[model samples]
Structure formats: structure tokens, C-alpha cells
Target: MKLVVQEFLTLDGVSQGPGAPDEDTSDGFTRGGWFVPFVDEEFMEIVDGWLAQADGLLLGRRTYENFARDWPAMTDHPNGAIMNGLPKYVATQSLTEAHWDPTTILAGNIVAEVDALKRQPGRELQIHGSARLAQSLLAAGLVDQLRLAIAPVVVGRGRRLFPEGSTPAGLRPVSQHTTKAGLSVHVFDTAGLPSYGIYEG
Candidate 1:
């Protein structure tokens, strides 16, 4: 199984709070819902395509809690059944019990646990909206592909996916496109450590 990370980001690279104004208020992040405006029919179609390829979901503690609470009740949503029914894995030490059906808590060396999961036979084991977990996996060179929907707005402050002093990575572009609502979607395959080069005058 290839670990794929799908994320929504602001122009300034803020990954926190892309759903609703109160979706993620951690650390006083008020600039929420920055990515909501760019959701057109085309964007949703693209998203649906991605969801169809998901064999399982890997989520962070916060994201897992949110999804576990909301997805079960979204009966009217077209993708609700898919979201609710997929096998879910959460990376956490704090969560002893998960109310969501088919959820497994991964504790003690999360990297190793996730690596073991990647060894299983399947399609894509996707990580959706778990920026922190995605960051850690990317740093460990475990993420095989990344799909980013970059909104055309600049959120002045929020937790970024790649913060200062983060591990450097190299990516080769697999695909890219801009939506009618100004979302620039990009897909990239992870390369190893970024190569450095010097320019001669």
C-alpha cells in the first residue's frame, strides 16, 4: 500500500482550519475555512475520484475525532458512505478507545506501525487532513505521493504543513491543474532528499 497524503493549503502554506470557522481553533487559529470558497463541481469530482481509490484512511488524533463525529451522520452526502465505511487507522497515544467502528489506534513507534501498514497488500492508504501526521511521515520518507489543493488566499497565521526547521524533501510533479474557483491542485511523487545545486555567474 502506498501512503498518499491529501491536503488543502492557503497561499501562505497554512494547513490548519480549512473546513469551517470552528473546525480547528487550536492555538487561536481564526483564519479557518480558507479553502471552502474554491469548492466547485469540478473540484468535487476530482475529490470523488481520489476517494474512490482509497483502500483505507490514516488520520491524526484531531482529524480522527472530527471525522468520527461527523462522517457517520452525513447520510445525505454522496461520499458519506465511503467515508464512514472505510477502514480507519488513527495514530495516537491519548486515545485508548475509539468509538468509530473499524478504527485501530497506533501507539508506540507510530512510524514503524505505519511502515508495517504500508507493507500490507492494497491500493492507496490515504491520509486526509492530517497535516501533522503527514509531516512526520514525509520527514521519515514514507509518503509515496502528495495531492495538494492550494487555495488562492493567504492566511496570515495558522499551523503550516511544513514548519520552520522541517525536514527537506524532493518531489516530482505527477500532475497539476487550476480549478474554476481558483484552486491550484497539484499531484507529486516523493523523491528522496532534495538535491542541492550552485549556479555559476
Candidate 2:
């Protein structure tokens, strides 16, 4: 199984609280739900297509809670309906019991558990809006592909997708598309040598 990580981010690389203003205010972030107005049918079509191809969903604790309360109540689609019914793996250290149906807390090491999931024979394991989890997975060299929807506006400051302290890896752009609002959907697959290309002469 391949791990495909997807995220909707602002041009300034802010991925926190894309769904709610009060969801995460850790850093005095008042601009939440910035991606809501830009969700056209064309964008929704792209999202629906991706959601349809998932074998399972991987989520961080906060994203899991958001999805658990929202997806089941969202509009019914053949694919979206199936996603709500599939098993979701949540990476959490504090969660012992799940409040939502078909949810599992990762018990072992994050890398080990995700590695086991990647080894299983199944469809692509999809991840969405789990920035912290994605950071760990990317650092461990477990993510197979990245689907990023870069929104138009910039938030100037917020939580970044890639934090400090991680080995560098090469990324090859496999595909690209543009949304109606000028958001670039870049798809990159891990490829080539994992080395810094620039060095002092």
C-alpha cells in the first residue's frame, strides 16, 4: 500500500485551522476557514476524486476529531459515503477510546505502525490535513506521494508544514493542475538522490 499525503494550504504555507476560526488558536491565528470561499465545484471534483481512491484514511488526533464530527454529516456522495464508512487510523498518544465509529488509535511506534500499513496489500492509504503526522512520516521517508493544493492568499505567519530537524530528500514533480481561483495542485513523488544540490564552491 502506498501512502499518499494531501493538504490544502495557503500560499504562505499555513495549514492550521483551515476549517474553523476557533478550532486551533494556539498562535493567535484569527484567520481560519480561509479555504472555504475558494472551494468551487472544480476543486470539489478534484477532492472527491482523491477521496474516492482511498483504501484507508490516516489522521492525526485533531484532524480525526474534526472529520469525525463533520464527514458523516456532509452531503452524500458515493465516494464520500464510502470514506465515512472506512476504517480510520488516528496517530495519537492520549486517545485510549475512540468516540467515533470505525476508528483506531495507533498503539505502537508511529513509523512502525505506518510501515506495517504500507506493507499491507490494499489500495492507497490516504492522508489529509495531518500536518504534524505528515511531517513525521516524511522525515521517516514513508510518504509515497504528495498532493498539495496551494491556495492563493498568504497568511504571512502560522504553523509550517515542514519543521526543523529532518534529513533532506529529493522531490520530483509528477503532475500539476490549476484551480479556478489560481490554486496550484502540485503532485510530487519521491525520486532521485537525497542530497543537497548546492554547496560552497
Q: Which residue pairs clash within candidate 2?
A: none
- Least lDDT summed over 10 consecutive residues: which range in candidate 1? 29-38
Model 2 regions more than 4 Å off: 75-79, 192-201
Segments of candidate 1 deviating more than 4 angstroms: none
Residues 1-201 of candidate 1: C-alpha lDDT, one tens digit per residue: 999999999989999999999999999998798888889999999999999999999999999999999999998999998988899999998999999988999988999999999999999999999999999999999999999999999989999999998999999999999999999999999999889999998
State the C-alpha lDDT per candidate: 0.95, 0.84
* TM-score: model 1 vs. ground truth: 0.98
Error of 1 at 69 (Å): 0.7
TM-score of each predicted structure versus truth: 0.98, 0.91
Colliding pairs, model 1: none
